[model samples]
Target: MKRRSLLKLGLGGAVLLGLVGGGMALLKPGLVDKHMSPSARELMRAVALSVMDGLWPAPGAARDAALQAHLDRVDANIGGYPAAVRAELSQLFALLSSSGGRLALIGMSQDWPKASVAEIQELLNELRLSSLDLRQQIYHALRDLNTIAFFTAPEHWASTGYPGPREIP
Candidate 1:
Protein backbone atom coordinates (compact mmCIF):
# COMPACT_ATOMS: atom_id res chain seq x y z
CA MET A 1 0.00 0.00 0.00
CA LYS A 2 1.91 3.06 -1.26
CA ARG A 3 0.87 6.52 -0.08
CA ARG A 4 -0.68 7.45 -3.47
CA SER A 5 -2.63 4.19 -3.66
CA LEU A 6 -3.97 4.71 -0.09
CA LEU A 7 -5.11 8.26 -0.95
CA LYS A 8 -6.90 7.08 -4.09
CA LEU A 9 -8.63 4.27 -2.22
CA GLY A 10 -9.84 6.64 0.50
CA LEU A 11 -11.19 9.10 -2.06
CA GLY A 12 -12.96 6.31 -3.93
CA GLY A 13 -14.56 5.08 -0.72
CA ALA A 14 -15.78 8.58 0.07
CA VAL A 15 -17.30 8.99 -3.36
CA LEU A 16 -19.01 5.62 -3.16
CA LEU A 17 -20.46 6.43 0.25
CA GLY A 18 -21.70 9.79 -0.97
CA LEU A 19 -23.45 8.19 -3.91
CA VAL A 20 -25.07 5.55 -1.73
CA GLY A 21 -26.21 8.09 0.82
CA GLY A 22 -27.71 10.32 -1.83
CA GLY A 23 -29.52 7.42 -3.43
CA MET A 24 -30.95 6.29 -0.08
CA ALA A 25 -32.15 9.77 0.71
CA LEU A 26 -33.98 9.94 -2.59
CA LEU A 27 -35.51 6.48 -2.25
CA LYS A 28 -36.80 6.92 1.31
CA PRO A 29 -37.61 10.54 1.95
CA GLY A 30 -39.77 9.47 4.90
CA LEU A 31 -36.73 8.32 6.88
CA VAL A 32 -36.66 11.56 8.83
CA ASP A 33 -35.96 10.60 12.43
CA LYS A 34 -35.93 13.67 14.68
CA HIS A 35 -37.84 16.50 13.03
CA MET A 36 -39.79 17.33 9.92
CA SER A 37 -37.81 17.52 6.69
CA PRO A 38 -37.77 20.64 4.49
CA SER A 39 -40.26 19.13 2.04
CA ALA A 40 -42.66 18.33 4.86
CA ARG A 41 -42.29 21.84 6.23
CA GLU A 42 -43.15 23.33 2.84
CA LEU A 43 -46.20 21.10 2.56
CA MET A 44 -47.34 22.11 6.03
CA ARG A 45 -46.76 25.77 5.24
CA ALA A 46 -49.07 25.52 2.26
CA VAL A 47 -51.62 23.71 4.37
CA ALA A 48 -51.44 26.42 7.00
CA LEU A 49 -52.08 29.09 4.37
CA SER A 50 -55.16 27.29 3.12
CA VAL A 51 -56.49 26.30 6.51
CA MET A 52 -55.92 29.65 8.21
CA ASP A 53 -56.60 31.84 5.20
CA GLY A 54 -59.36 34.01 6.62
CA LEU A 55 -58.09 34.10 10.20
CA TRP A 56 -55.42 36.70 9.58
CA PRO A 57 -56.20 39.51 7.20
CA ALA A 58 -52.96 41.42 7.57
CA PRO A 59 -51.03 41.74 4.32
CA GLY A 60 -47.31 41.92 3.45
CA ALA A 61 -44.72 41.18 6.13
CA ALA A 62 -47.26 40.98 8.94
CA ARG A 63 -49.08 38.07 7.35
CA ASP A 64 -45.82 36.33 6.47
CA ALA A 65 -44.49 36.67 10.02
CA ALA A 66 -47.71 35.37 11.53
CA LEU A 67 -47.73 32.35 9.26
CA GLN A 68 -44.06 31.61 9.96
CA ALA A 69 -44.63 31.93 13.69
CA HIS A 70 -47.62 29.63 13.57
CA LEU A 71 -45.53 27.10 11.69
CA ASP A 72 -42.77 27.38 14.30
CA ARG A 73 -45.29 26.75 17.05
CA VAL A 74 -46.72 23.78 15.20
CA ASP A 75 -43.23 22.39 14.65
CA ALA A 76 -42.39 22.73 18.33
CA ASN A 77 -45.61 20.99 19.30
CA ILE A 78 -44.97 18.16 16.91
CA GLY A 79 -41.40 17.82 18.18
CA GLY A 80 -42.69 17.30 21.73
CA TYR A 81 -45.04 14.48 20.79
CA PRO A 82 -44.19 10.86 21.55
CA ALA A 83 -42.10 8.90 19.08
CA ALA A 84 -45.01 6.83 17.77
CA VAL A 85 -47.12 9.91 17.13
CA ARG A 86 -44.20 11.69 15.50
CA ALA A 87 -43.56 8.71 13.28
CA GLU A 88 -47.17 8.62 12.16
CA LEU A 89 -47.16 12.32 11.40
CA SER A 90 -43.85 12.00 9.57
CA GLN A 91 -45.25 9.20 7.44
CA LEU A 92 -48.32 11.22 6.59
CA PHE A 93 -46.20 14.22 5.73
CA ALA A 94 -43.96 12.12 3.54
CA LEU A 95 -46.95 10.64 1.76
CA LEU A 96 -48.40 14.05 1.15
CA SER A 97 -44.99 15.21 -0.08
CA SER A 98 -45.12 12.74 -2.93
CA SER A 99 -46.97 13.63 -6.12
CA GLY A 100 -49.03 10.42 -6.21
CA GLY A 101 -50.15 10.76 -2.61
CA ARG A 102 -50.96 14.43 -3.11
CA LEU A 103 -53.11 13.57 -6.11
CA ALA A 104 -54.88 10.76 -4.33
CA LEU A 105 -55.51 12.57 -1.06
CA ILE A 106 -56.00 16.12 -2.29
CA GLY A 107 -57.56 15.24 -5.66
CA MET A 108 -55.32 17.84 -7.27
CA SER A 109 -52.58 17.32 -9.80
CA GLN A 110 -50.99 20.65 -8.97
CA ASP A 111 -48.56 21.40 -6.18
CA TRP A 112 -50.01 22.18 -2.78
CA PRO A 113 -48.74 25.75 -2.80
CA LYS A 114 -50.11 26.33 -6.29
CA ALA A 115 -53.58 24.97 -5.46
CA SER A 116 -56.04 27.82 -5.08
CA VAL A 117 -57.71 28.54 -1.78
CA ALA A 118 -60.98 27.27 -3.23
CA GLU A 119 -59.30 24.07 -4.37
CA ILE A 120 -57.80 23.55 -0.95
CA GLN A 121 -61.18 24.17 0.68
CA GLU A 122 -62.81 21.64 -1.60
CA LEU A 123 -60.20 19.05 -0.78
CA LEU A 124 -60.55 19.77 2.89
CA ASN A 125 -64.28 19.34 2.69
CA GLU A 126 -63.85 16.04 0.93
CA LEU A 127 -61.42 14.87 3.58
CA ARG A 128 -63.79 15.96 6.33
CA LEU A 129 -66.60 13.96 4.82
CA SER A 130 -64.48 11.04 3.68
CA SER A 131 -65.67 7.53 4.57
CA LEU A 132 -62.11 6.47 5.22
CA ASP A 133 -61.07 7.03 8.80
CA LEU A 134 -57.52 8.04 7.93
CA ARG A 135 -58.60 10.88 5.65
CA GLN A 136 -60.89 12.30 8.31
CA GLN A 137 -58.19 11.91 10.91
CA ILE A 138 -55.65 13.77 8.78
CA TYR A 139 -58.12 16.59 8.19
CA HIS A 140 -58.78 16.88 11.90
CA ALA A 141 -55.07 16.84 12.68
CA LEU A 142 -54.24 19.62 10.23
CA ARG A 143 -57.30 21.69 11.18
CA ASP A 144 -56.77 21.34 14.89
CA LEU A 145 -53.09 22.19 14.67
CA ASN A 146 -53.76 25.24 12.52
CA THR A 147 -56.68 26.51 14.59
CA ILE A 148 -54.99 26.00 17.90
CA ALA A 149 -51.76 27.60 16.78
CA PHE A 150 -53.53 30.66 15.40
CA PHE A 151 -56.05 31.36 18.17
CA THR A 152 -53.85 30.59 21.16
CA ALA A 153 -51.34 33.29 20.27
CA PRO A 154 -51.51 36.32 22.57
CA GLU A 155 -51.52 38.81 19.69
CA HIS A 156 -54.82 37.41 18.45
CA TRP A 157 -56.42 37.69 21.88
CA ALA A 158 -58.26 40.90 20.95
CA SER A 159 -60.13 39.02 18.25
CA THR A 160 -61.57 36.83 20.98
CA GLY A 161 -62.29 39.86 23.20
CA TYR A 162 -59.84 38.51 25.75
CA PRO A 163 -58.40 41.35 27.76
CA GLY A 164 -54.95 41.05 29.27
CA PRO A 165 -54.73 39.13 32.53
CA ARG A 166 -55.65 41.31 35.54
CA GLU A 167 -52.80 40.22 37.86
CA ILE A 168 -50.31 43.02 37.28
CA PRO A 169 -47.23 42.77 39.47
Candidate 2:
Protein backbone atom coordinates (compact mmCIF):
# COMPACT_ATOMS: atom_id res chain seq x y z
CA MET A 1 0.00 0.00 0.00
CA LYS A 2 2.80 2.48 0.83
CA ARG A 3 4.67 1.79 -2.46
CA ARG A 4 1.46 2.06 -4.43
CA SER A 5 0.63 5.40 -2.81
CA LEU A 6 4.09 6.81 -3.66
CA LEU A 7 3.75 5.75 -7.28
CA LYS A 8 0.35 7.38 -7.54
CA LEU A 9 1.68 10.62 -6.06
CA GLY A 10 4.61 10.67 -8.49
CA LEU A 11 2.35 10.12 -11.48
CA GLY A 12 -0.03 12.84 -10.33
CA GLY A 13 2.84 15.35 -10.06
CA ALA A 14 4.02 14.47 -13.56
CA VAL A 15 0.51 14.95 -14.90
CA LEU A 16 0.23 18.28 -13.18
CA LEU A 17 3.55 19.47 -14.61
CA GLY A 18 2.53 18.39 -18.09
CA LEU A 19 -0.81 20.17 -17.82
CA VAL A 20 0.84 23.41 -16.65
CA GLY A 21 3.42 23.30 -19.42
CA GLY A 22 0.79 22.61 -22.05
CA GLY A 23 -1.45 25.39 -20.79
CA MET A 24 1.31 27.97 -20.94
CA ALA A 25 2.32 26.83 -24.43
CA LEU A 26 -1.25 27.13 -25.68
CA LEU A 27 -1.79 30.47 -23.98
CA LYS A 28 1.06 32.09 -25.87
CA PRO A 29 1.41 29.90 -28.93
CA GLY A 30 3.27 32.48 -30.96
CA LEU A 31 5.09 34.42 -28.28
CA VAL A 32 8.01 36.53 -29.45
CA ASP A 33 10.58 37.76 -26.96
CA LYS A 34 10.70 41.53 -26.43
CA HIS A 35 12.45 44.19 -24.38
CA MET A 36 11.99 47.89 -23.75
CA SER A 37 14.58 50.64 -23.27
CA PRO A 38 14.66 54.40 -23.56
CA SER A 39 17.12 54.70 -26.44
CA ALA A 40 15.53 51.87 -28.39
CA ARG A 41 12.09 53.34 -27.92
CA GLU A 42 13.32 56.75 -29.04
CA LEU A 43 15.13 55.35 -32.08
CA MET A 44 12.10 53.30 -33.11
CA ARG A 45 9.96 56.39 -32.82
CA ALA A 46 12.38 58.29 -35.05
CA VAL A 47 12.33 55.55 -37.67
CA ALA A 48 8.56 55.22 -37.52
CA LEU A 49 8.17 58.96 -37.89
CA SER A 50 10.53 58.90 -40.87
CA VAL A 51 8.52 56.09 -42.40
CA MET A 52 5.31 58.05 -41.82
CA ASP A 53 6.82 61.07 -43.51
CA GLY A 54 7.89 58.88 -46.37
CA LEU A 55 4.39 57.50 -46.84
CA TRP A 56 2.74 60.89 -46.31
CA PRO A 57 5.24 63.75 -46.41
CA ALA A 58 3.98 65.71 -43.38
CA PRO A 59 1.94 68.07 -45.65
CA GLY A 60 3.81 71.19 -44.36
CA ALA A 61 6.58 72.87 -42.39
CA ALA A 62 5.07 72.43 -38.92
CA ARG A 63 5.03 68.68 -39.29
CA ASP A 64 8.54 68.66 -40.67
CA ALA A 65 9.72 70.66 -37.66
CA ALA A 66 8.08 68.21 -35.28
CA LEU A 67 9.71 65.28 -37.06
CA GLN A 68 13.15 66.89 -36.93
CA ALA A 69 12.66 67.66 -33.25
CA HIS A 70 11.94 64.03 -32.59
CA LEU A 71 14.99 62.92 -34.57
CA ASP A 72 17.25 65.33 -32.72
CA ARG A 73 16.02 64.04 -29.39
CA VAL A 74 16.94 60.49 -30.34
CA ASP A 75 20.27 61.31 -31.91
CA ALA A 76 21.47 63.36 -28.98
CA ASN A 77 24.13 61.69 -26.79
CA ILE A 78 24.16 58.68 -29.14
CA GLY A 79 27.92 58.86 -29.76
CA GLY A 80 28.61 57.66 -26.22
CA TYR A 81 25.46 55.60 -25.62
CA PRO A 82 26.19 52.35 -23.74
CA ALA A 83 27.02 49.22 -25.72
CA ALA A 84 23.66 47.66 -25.02
CA VAL A 85 22.01 50.96 -25.80
CA ARG A 86 24.11 51.30 -28.93
CA ALA A 87 23.36 47.76 -30.09
CA GLU A 88 19.59 48.20 -30.00
CA LEU A 89 19.77 51.58 -31.70
CA SER A 90 22.08 50.23 -34.41
CA GLN A 91 19.84 47.24 -35.14
CA LEU A 92 16.79 49.47 -35.58
CA PHE A 93 18.73 51.90 -37.78
CA ALA A 94 19.92 49.04 -39.98
CA LEU A 95 16.39 47.89 -40.75
CA LEU A 96 15.10 51.33 -41.63
CA SER A 97 18.35 52.64 -43.04
CA SER A 98 18.56 49.90 -45.69
CA SER A 99 14.99 50.05 -46.98
CA GLY A 100 13.41 53.16 -45.53
CA GLY A 101 14.78 55.51 -48.17
CA ARG A 102 13.01 53.71 -51.01
CA LEU A 103 9.60 53.54 -49.35
CA ALA A 104 8.46 56.71 -51.09
CA LEU A 105 9.79 55.42 -54.37
CA ILE A 106 7.71 52.27 -54.17
CA GLY A 107 4.57 53.90 -52.77
CA MET A 108 4.37 56.66 -55.36
CA SER A 109 5.31 54.51 -58.32
CA GLN A 110 2.68 53.54 -60.88
CA ASP A 111 4.07 50.05 -61.34
CA TRP A 112 3.21 48.94 -57.77
CA PRO A 113 -0.48 49.89 -57.58
CA LYS A 114 -1.03 48.97 -61.26
CA ALA A 115 0.22 45.43 -60.72
CA SER A 116 -2.23 42.53 -60.52
CA VAL A 117 -4.25 42.36 -57.34
CA ALA A 118 -2.22 39.42 -56.09
CA GLU A 119 1.03 41.21 -56.85
CA ILE A 120 -0.12 44.35 -55.13
CA GLN A 121 -1.14 42.33 -52.10
CA GLU A 122 2.25 40.65 -52.09
CA LEU A 123 4.02 43.99 -52.15
CA LEU A 124 1.92 45.28 -49.29
CA ASN A 125 2.53 42.11 -47.34
CA GLU A 126 6.26 42.41 -47.88
CA LEU A 127 6.24 45.97 -46.64
CA ARG A 128 4.20 45.01 -43.61
CA LEU A 129 6.52 42.13 -42.76
CA SER A 130 9.62 44.26 -43.18
CA SER A 131 8.24 46.89 -40.86
CA LEU A 132 7.28 44.28 -38.33
CA ASP A 133 10.73 42.75 -38.56
CA LEU A 134 12.37 46.10 -37.88
CA ARG A 135 10.04 46.75 -34.96
CA GLN A 136 10.80 43.34 -33.50
CA GLN A 137 14.55 43.93 -33.67
CA ILE A 138 14.07 47.21 -31.87
CA TYR A 139 11.97 45.49 -29.24
CA HIS A 140 14.47 42.72 -28.65
CA ALA A 141 17.37 45.16 -28.45
CA LEU A 142 15.51 47.36 -26.01
CA ARG A 143 14.50 44.38 -23.96
CA ASP A 144 18.08 43.17 -23.92
CA LEU A 145 19.21 46.51 -22.55
CA ASN A 146 16.53 46.37 -19.88
CA THR A 147 17.54 42.86 -18.88
CA ILE A 148 21.20 43.81 -18.74
CA ALA A 149 20.38 46.75 -16.55
CA PHE A 150 18.40 44.56 -14.20
CA PHE A 151 21.40 42.30 -13.57
CA THR A 152 24.34 44.51 -14.46
CA ALA A 153 23.40 48.14 -14.10
CA PRO A 154 26.91 49.52 -13.99
CA GLU A 155 28.38 47.72 -16.99
CA HIS A 156 27.19 50.16 -19.59
CA TRP A 157 26.94 53.24 -17.46
CA ALA A 158 30.70 53.64 -17.48
CA SER A 159 30.43 55.13 -20.94
CA THR A 160 29.99 58.45 -19.16
CA GLY A 161 32.83 57.44 -16.82
CA TYR A 162 32.98 59.82 -13.85
CA PRO A 163 29.43 61.02 -14.33
CA GLY A 164 27.97 57.72 -15.60
CA PRO A 165 24.14 57.55 -16.01
CA ARG A 166 22.36 60.38 -14.31
CA GLU A 167 21.79 59.88 -10.59
CA ILE A 168 18.25 61.20 -10.75
CA PRO A 169 16.79 57.75 -11.14
Candidate 3:
Protein backbone atom coordinates (compact mmCIF):
# COMPACT_ATOMS: atom_id res chain seq x y z
CA MET A 1 0.00 0.00 0.00
CA LYS A 2 1.08 3.58 -0.62
CA ARG A 3 2.36 5.55 2.39
CA ARG A 4 -0.68 7.77 2.34
CA SER A 5 -3.03 4.79 2.22
CA LEU A 6 -1.20 3.07 5.07
CA LEU A 7 -1.45 6.14 7.26
CA LYS A 8 -5.13 6.52 6.42
CA LEU A 9 -5.81 2.90 7.29
CA GLY A 10 -4.07 3.20 10.63
CA LEU A 11 -5.89 6.39 11.49
CA GLY A 12 -9.21 4.89 10.50
CA GLY A 13 -8.60 1.85 12.68
CA ALA A 14 -7.75 4.05 15.66
CA VAL A 15 -10.93 6.08 15.18
CA LEU A 16 -13.02 2.94 14.98
CA LEU A 17 -11.49 1.56 18.14
CA GLY A 18 -12.10 4.82 19.98
CA LEU A 19 -15.73 4.90 18.86
CA VAL A 20 -16.33 1.34 19.99
CA GLY A 21 -14.73 1.99 23.34
CA GLY A 22 -16.69 5.17 23.85
CA GLY A 23 -19.90 3.37 22.91
CA MET A 24 -19.17 0.67 25.45
CA ALA A 25 -18.59 3.29 28.13
CA LEU A 26 -21.84 5.02 27.24
CA LEU A 27 -23.80 1.80 27.31
CA LYS A 28 -22.76 1.29 30.92
CA PRO A 29 -23.37 4.76 32.25
CA GLY A 30 -22.22 3.80 35.74
CA LEU A 31 -18.89 2.72 34.33
CA VAL A 32 -18.12 6.22 33.14
CA ASP A 33 -18.99 7.94 36.39
CA LYS A 34 -17.36 8.15 39.81
CA HIS A 35 -18.84 4.86 40.85
CA MET A 36 -16.69 2.01 39.60
CA SER A 37 -18.47 -0.90 38.02
CA PRO A 38 -17.67 -4.37 39.39
CA SER A 39 -15.31 -5.07 36.51
CA ALA A 40 -13.46 -1.79 36.99
CA ARG A 41 -13.13 -2.51 40.68
CA GLU A 42 -11.69 -5.92 39.99
CA LEU A 43 -9.24 -4.52 37.46
CA MET A 44 -8.11 -1.86 39.89
CA ARG A 45 -7.81 -4.35 42.73
CA ALA A 46 -5.40 -6.42 40.69
CA VAL A 47 -3.54 -3.32 39.64
CA ALA A 48 -3.30 -2.15 43.26
CA LEU A 49 -1.88 -5.44 44.40
CA SER A 50 0.72 -5.42 41.67
CA VAL A 51 1.62 -1.77 41.85
CA MET A 52 1.69 -1.38 45.61
CA ASP A 53 3.50 -4.67 46.26
CA GLY A 54 5.32 -4.25 49.58
CA LEU A 55 3.08 -1.45 50.72
CA TRP A 56 0.04 -3.67 50.29
CA PRO A 57 -1.00 -5.95 53.11
CA ALA A 58 -0.50 -9.68 52.95
CA PRO A 59 -3.08 -12.04 51.42
CA GLY A 60 -5.67 -12.12 54.19
CA ALA A 61 -8.60 -10.28 55.66
CA ALA A 62 -6.52 -7.22 56.36
CA ARG A 63 -5.40 -7.12 52.78
CA ASP A 64 -8.94 -7.50 51.53
CA ALA A 65 -10.20 -4.70 53.75
CA ALA A 66 -7.28 -2.47 52.82
CA LEU A 67 -7.86 -3.09 49.15
CA GLN A 68 -11.52 -2.23 49.49
CA ALA A 69 -10.68 0.98 51.32
CA HIS A 70 -8.14 1.89 48.70
CA LEU A 71 -10.68 1.32 45.96
CA ASP A 72 -13.19 3.48 47.77
CA ARG A 73 -10.64 6.27 48.04
CA VAL A 74 -9.83 5.90 44.37
CA ASP A 75 -13.52 6.28 43.55
CA ALA A 76 -13.73 9.38 45.68
CA ASN A 77 -10.63 10.80 44.06
CA ILE A 78 -11.98 10.17 40.59
CA GLY A 79 -15.25 11.78 41.62
CA GLY A 80 -13.39 15.01 42.36
CA TYR A 81 -11.71 15.08 38.94
CA PRO A 82 -13.00 17.17 36.06
CA ALA A 83 -15.57 15.60 33.78
CA ALA A 84 -13.12 15.20 30.90
CA VAL A 85 -10.56 13.47 33.10
CA ARG A 86 -13.21 11.12 34.46
CA ALA A 87 -14.30 10.31 30.93
CA GLU A 88 -10.79 9.46 29.90
CA LEU A 89 -10.26 7.28 32.97
CA SER A 90 -13.56 5.55 32.31
CA GLN A 91 -12.45 4.74 28.78
CA LEU A 92 -9.15 3.38 30.03
CA PHE A 93 -10.90 1.24 32.62
CA ALA A 94 -13.42 -0.02 30.06
CA LEU A 95 -10.66 -0.98 27.67
CA LEU A 96 -8.67 -2.80 30.34
CA SER A 97 -11.77 -4.69 31.51
CA SER A 98 -12.20 -6.39 28.13
CA SER A 99 -10.56 -9.70 27.31
CA GLY A 100 -8.95 -8.48 24.12
CA GLY A 101 -7.70 -5.39 25.89
CA ARG A 102 -6.29 -7.47 28.72
CA LEU A 103 -4.26 -9.51 26.30
CA ALA A 104 -3.24 -6.71 23.99
CA LEU A 105 -2.41 -4.10 26.58
CA ILE A 106 -1.05 -6.20 29.45
CA GLY A 107 -0.39 -9.56 27.75
CA MET A 108 -2.58 -11.28 30.32
CA SER A 109 -5.10 -13.69 28.90
CA GLN A 110 -6.61 -14.63 32.25
CA ASP A 111 -9.04 -12.48 34.15
CA TRP A 112 -7.64 -9.99 36.66
CA PRO A 113 -8.88 -11.87 39.71
CA LYS A 114 -7.09 -15.02 38.66
CA ALA A 115 -3.86 -13.42 37.59
CA SER A 116 -0.96 -13.62 40.07
CA VAL A 117 0.69 -10.51 41.38
CA ALA A 118 3.97 -11.54 39.77
CA GLU A 119 2.29 -11.88 36.41
CA ILE A 120 0.52 -8.58 36.78
CA GLN A 121 3.71 -6.91 37.94
CA GLU A 122 5.61 -8.15 34.90
CA LEU A 123 2.91 -6.89 32.59
CA LEU A 124 2.83 -3.55 34.42
CA ASN A 125 6.60 -3.25 34.09
CA GLU A 126 6.27 -3.85 30.38
CA LEU A 127 3.72 -1.05 30.20
CA ARG A 128 5.94 1.26 32.25
CA LEU A 129 8.90 0.68 29.95
CA SER A 130 6.95 0.38 26.72
CA SER A 131 8.04 2.57 23.82
CA LEU A 132 4.39 3.36 23.20
CA ASP A 133 3.33 6.56 24.92
CA LEU A 134 -0.17 5.22 25.51
CA ARG A 135 1.08 2.23 27.47
CA GLN A 136 3.36 4.36 29.57
CA GLN A 137 0.51 6.71 30.29
CA ILE A 138 -1.63 3.82 31.44
CA TYR A 139 1.12 2.65 33.73
CA HIS A 140 1.48 6.07 35.27
CA ALA A 141 -2.24 6.53 35.78
CA LEU A 142 -2.63 3.17 37.50
CA ARG A 143 0.44 3.62 39.65
CA ASP A 144 -0.48 7.12 40.67
CA LEU A 145 -4.03 6.22 41.57
CA ASN A 146 -2.94 3.31 43.71
CA THR A 147 -0.16 5.23 45.36
CA ILE A 148 -2.35 8.20 46.15
CA ALA A 149 -5.16 6.09 47.53
CA PHE A 150 -2.88 4.02 49.70
CA PHE A 151 -0.92 6.87 51.17
CA THR A 152 -3.63 9.40 51.72
CA ALA A 153 -4.98 7.57 54.74
CA PRO A 154 -3.46 8.62 58.06
CA GLU A 155 -3.23 4.96 59.01
CA HIS A 156 -0.76 4.37 56.19
CA TRP A 157 1.26 7.51 56.85
CA ALA A 158 3.41 5.70 59.35
CA SER A 159 4.92 3.56 56.64
CA THR A 160 6.14 6.61 54.78
CA GLY A 161 7.08 8.37 58.01
CA TYR A 162 4.84 11.27 57.11
CA PRO A 163 3.83 12.77 60.41
CA GLY A 164 0.24 13.87 60.29
CA PRO A 165 -0.06 17.27 58.65
CA ARG A 166 1.05 19.85 61.20
CA GLU A 167 -1.87 21.06 63.28
CA ILE A 168 -2.97 24.39 61.88
CA PRO A 169 -3.97 26.78 64.66
lDDT of each: 0.75, 0.41, 0.84
1-169, model 3: which lDDT tens digit per residue? 8999999999998888778777766765435447788899998899999887898777799988998899999999989988888888887888788876666566778998999989989988889999999899999998898888889888999999999899889
TM-score of 1: 0.74
Provide the global lDDT of candidate 3 against the true structure. 0.84
TM-score sort, best first: 3, 1, 2
Please identify model 2 stretches exceeding 4 Å from their true place. 1-46, 50-58, 77-80, 99-135, 139-169
The worst-scoring run of ten residues by lDDT in candidate 3 lies at 24-33
Number of the top-ranking candidate, with TM-score as the measure: 3
TM-score list, all predictions: 0.74, 0.29, 0.87
Clashing pairs in 3: none
Residues 102-160, model 1: lDDT tens digits:
66555668877787878888888899999999789989987887778777889878887
- Candidate 3: how many backbone clashes? 0
Give the lDDT ranking, best first: 3, 1, 2
